[model samples]
Target: MKTTLTVLLIIQLYGLASCAIKQHYFINQMKTWDEARQYCRTNYHNLSTFINEIEKQQFLQDAVNQTSDAWIGLNKPSGTWKWTTGEVTTQISWDTGEPDNDFCAYLHKDSKKLHDRDCSNTQTFFCMKVTVNTVMVQQSESWEGALEYCRHHHDDLASLSSSRSMTDALSKITGAQTQYVWIGLRFLAGGWFWISGDDLILNVWSSAGPPQCPAQNQRCAALDKNTQTWTPRDCEEKLNFLCFK
Candidate 1:
């Protein structure tokens, strides 16, 4: 009996450790899509990176029970789908016939599924906080200007790789109404593309598909308030941009 009890105790301990290894991290509050993206980038490496279908399912299950709609690291810039962490999407478990290009990406609580959302539409975000040292440099330029500034100084704008990283970045710069900052993302050409010219293999455009460039000369991108997805806007338009060291 004593040996059996010891074995059971060991098994229980092992189970606990396994749970910790795969624990889901989430923010306690809600935030806008841009704000949430920045939040994750500042503290963590990037937005939370979903490993596989099981991890994605577990995140949805945990978020459904929570108050806020969690933010995943998915974004469509220039009609190209990529994670904030600069990693190309490999595995996707979207609902049958999902990621219809509209504007934004969201998670449906009732269905426990993911959907595209408008960039401007505000929603609650879930961030996974992690420990990392990040450095921010100041630049005097508009959002698009800042992107140019980063290109001149360092690599492209910051990228979100994981969900925990996204949460951590969001937590660091919480508060104030003007929390949204520009990322390396922008809509260029007719398709949603990135600053680094990385091809977006994972597409999550809204139902109407991606928005067409207003003009042939439109090379810059911005989040259109009307659509919420990255649209080819005049880069000269005034907006906020985020720079990383």
Candidate 2:
């Protein structure tokens, strides 16, 4: 009986460990910001783009054994920050009037904070693959239908990265009669990401991450009417969607 119970426990643990999460490759060799970007694009995805504390922590943790700073996917070419993920970066914690230089962003080796350097500065960089796959037309689509349409049209279902962006997505829903639209909020491997990610900035949730793991069926997200918060819903449900240009 004990042996049987041990086998059952092992099965449960293995099941919990499995998910659709994709991993990215990190290179230790130092190179300039543009060189690093070229290398990452040729070999893997763009430089790393982190949406929240979870991703930030994961990126840092992956480099726990590293010995130098690294270039990320953020750049201020025209005096504004832009993430390679195509999302406008509005959620970064600046370090004491940072971006003091306006070229590239890198994770500081010792501080773990961000600092901008000249684009030509050579540094080790993190490279990762773009996993949020697919595309669709700029029209009304159900969650599943949208997923299908996106896959067919070279778009993927939409994902809002934070609570603030929730309002931006909400603006796309034209009529009040339209109950709610689908946003790319998925649950896998014990965490949430925007394609399923959110850092709740409101006072309602104590932490930046989701307050709790959503129910199994509640794998998609929509705005909550009362508190203006985002909550997970069934993916099969039809709703308005927001997409990038």
Taking all chains together, each candidate's TM-score versus the true structure is 0.40, 0.48
lDDT of 2 by residue, 117-209 (tens): 988978898886544421223455555565455435544455544333444555555443345555555455575544422222222222354
Question: What C-alpha lDDT, on a 0 to 100 scale, does residue 118 get in candidate 2?
Answer: 89
> Can you tell me which runs of candidate 2 are displaced by over 4 Å?
1-24, 132-245
Q: Candidate 2 versus the native: TM-score?
A: 0.48
Candidate 2 positional error at 198, Å: 19
- Lowest-sum lDDT 10-residue window in model 1: 13-22
CA lDDT, every model vs. true structure: 0.48, 0.58
* Candidate 1 similarity to native, TM-score: 0.40
Clashes of each: 43, 11
Of candidate 2, the 10-residue stretch with the lowest lDDT total is: 13-22
Tens-digit lDDT string for candidate 1 (112-176): 56677777766666554333322243333454456556546754453323444234334433331
